[model samples]
Target chain A: MEILNRTKKEGDRTLLDDLAQKELSRRKFLRFSGMAGASALVISGVGLTGCVRDDDGSGTDGVNLGSGDIGILNYAYALEQLEAAFYTQVMATPYSGMNALEGEYLKDIRDHEIAHREFFKAALGTSAIQGLDVDFSSINFSSRDSVLATAKAFEDLGVAAYNGAGKLLVSADYLTLAGKIVSVEARHAALIRDLISNGSFADLASLAPLGANTANALDGALNPPQVLAIASTYVRNRIIANNLPTS
Target chain B: MNVHNLLHEIENVDPEVYDRLDSRRKVMKRFSFIGKTLALAAVPSALGSMFNKAYGQTNDDVKDVLLFAYLLENLEAEFYKGVVGTFAAIGVPAGPAQGALTVIRDHEVAHVAFLKTVLNSLGVTPPVYTAASFDFTGGNGSRMGPFAAAASNYGVMLAVAQTFEDTGVRAYKGQAPRLINNNDVLTAALQIHAVEARHASHIRQMRRNLASGSLVPAGVTLQPWITLAQSGIDTGNAGANAAIQMSYAGEEVVSQATVPITNIGGAVISANEASEAFDEPLTKAQVTAIVDPFVV
Candidate 1:
């Protein structure tokens, strides 16, 4: 993960800057309003039901993530679609020096991801969103470094997405299903991390600090906006998550 | 006094009593209907009570659930600490493998400290069990559990490591439903949950890399991703095998919520693939049963 520097096309800050900019601006206005003795009118800018966003770009440009458990399922399904597509490409174009063992493991991961993708598609039934349009042109699949690096990014992102989204589900079954799937993502993340660098399976940057001490923080728990920002770069289809939970 | 007899006498005394009683009964009926509706509508809090007996809380509360999580972190922390403490004796040579154990140990320690902070913030006293409290040997001071021999062997220690990490992953998942309404806590638990999964995966990988020896069980795929019962931990002995199975009883669950996942889209997914794709959660009883031996 790129370190936050408040300006860059790096992964961490892109989406957050857009979303947080709005939130911060709202706070500023309210603070100014409070000074003028209009304090009683302080309204919450974003809510847990979902954040308000204007990124639909006329509906077809991006996917509108719906409300409640269905929206959450759509979110998971979108991720699986991206993963399945990416791995399909990885296998289709093996990286240089990729061994038979790596191929076999990558194929297994690819299949599991496909199964998850189909599971959500079926579970969502008609409620499922359209297949996401993935843009892998930026990826250099022929290079081991780029392929594994991308794999690590996707796996880590998938794990964090599930971690943060698990709570937004109103249905216990959805939460359980998310739990069932997320750990597998975690396993893949570790394997990919090892492939990239052996020892740092759960790297420090992925740990979202609950407090100042690193011990109190959890590894790889990016909220929706932060995850989507990194994910949306590869995803050609716009992903709208207005209905997803905020809190 | 019998209310039935009193009502009967009152009915005989006044002819208009019957009409009055009927009106009162109708009002009571309305109240009962509304009461039933409200009760049915309050499922989340009721879901909260299923954990009450475990934590000694009245009605719905997450404190007991958090305490159970505290116990799990404690269990994992102590297991790793014991292995790190007995590194050379356990045949863990000074290398990356040993360093991996230290990483596992440190993560568990962090988890413990993190959970304790949450518990303290909630105004509930966290459990005071320390690394010294648990006897990971599972031998009540005798140090003779089937896994005891493995504790000293690096390869077998990896097996035990897999067991603890796998159990931790599922235990967090099992307890997640009770904390579903508490998103902050749920998010934190899940954050720890995946880290445990990463640990489990690497530990399995460590075992897979072992030289083909007595320690490596024959005829099993030792791939890092769990594939139901193809797990390399099967030692063929009944007691140890039972322990392994206990940690994995629900891992092969093809059922999601209530229905079969294979039934979705009428997809003909193999049971192995279906089960391997999704990790299952262990119930409180199931998890406790698996971890009880190491508890002391």
Candidate 2:
């Protein structure tokens, strides 16, 4: 499939080249180190007093969730952290026998993920989750099949997360944005899944066909608890428990 | 409990909430009421009163809804860019299928920007953050290779895409009811939703053809052909051991052995019909739970 040709022709190196540049920058590394140091200091200051409870002490610490919106935002922030950590690790030590093309693509994925993580960080500001230590003990980053399989799972789950969250939005503007982003996530999910299981792209009927499936099932949507299970390993703070709105 | 008993309970205990909802429902019934009142009386005052009434009820709902949409789009944006990035790292050339994916990605970007704009207009603070990274495979604490390893294996990608797209379609459908009051917003969401359906069908078709060599006749025009059968066959989780249960528009339709898409004249199964019936709306809790882990 002449992807290299197409990528070159299209000048779509924004994601790839951008990350590659950061890898070369001493300044970027220093900045990241500083941020890590700051995070440690902040974590220590709030470590004891941050353990807020929901009358049951089951919820995550350091989160002062006042409303349903805050709860939902926290949920999203957690997912972003998982994705960010995964990509960061992927870039740090790419799998063995990785081809140049594969290395390039993985690097791009890392860059994009970093961007997503940072975007959420900026948007959530004080509301965002502190960098929780991620445990990648489950993934085999050295194996080709293992990495792809994990990627597929993450992509599919990510798409479902966005799809599931759309209805909770009341604002038209937010709805529009959700619509736009979900479509992209859908594409990502589709592509990654296809990469994992060739020819599985058109196999929804076997998984959840129409008449048997609602519109919600098509995009791999998932609820908060479900999303939490998938993202749990990557996040240290527990999600503040809140009752989801029932139909 | 049976639906009959459920209905009885709703009528007996929760009459007020139901009645309040029913009263608002009537506003749609009498379309000319607002127009007539404005024309016959003090137009400005009547309009002002209408706005006032709507404003009070909408502010809270709008804030929550907007936040929900914003979060959804942000997640999607991060996911898609992840896809593009992941694939590029691998040697997989952006193929014909990749083009279709690109269109989908563009649409998602547009959705995110549009939602941000909408929230801005509403004077709501948008939650913008970094693009969340993704694990393309189910990383099991082992070293990994290129993100596009599935490119070498057709079964994996098809399964992943089918699941993801099916979820997207269902999620949008599930959310449609909440948006019915705003015609423009509803139309916009559905349009994008439908487009997502098309993407789902294309992926499903590719998988089906790859698996069993079942070809979708070229140039089929039926929406149901693409949506109902092909997309269904590819994305539905109806097996006895399926992790998640599914339905279409509240109907429990079973998955068929094959995509049965007959043309308008019954000559051959058309593509459009297969594409149109790919709708899958999910329950709200199901969606929230699925995305919760990612919510940092």
Residue-by-residue lDDT tens digits, candidate 1, A147-221: 998898899889889988886765566788899999999899898888777776876554443111246537667
Q: Tens digits of per-residue lDDT for model 2 on B88-154?
A: 5433246665655555556566667776776788787777655533333422212132223433334
Fnat value of model 2: 0.01
Worst 10 residues of 2 chain B by lDDT: B252-261
Top candidate (DockQ) = 1
Choose the strongest candidate by lDDT: 1
Estimate the TM-score of every prediction.
Answer: 0.77, 0.41
What are the Cα lDDT values of the candidates?
Answer: 0.70, 0.45
Model 2, which residues run further than 4 Å from truth?
A: A1-66, A205-217, A243-247, B1-296
Residues forming the 10-long window of minimal summed lDDT in candidate 1 chain B: B22-31
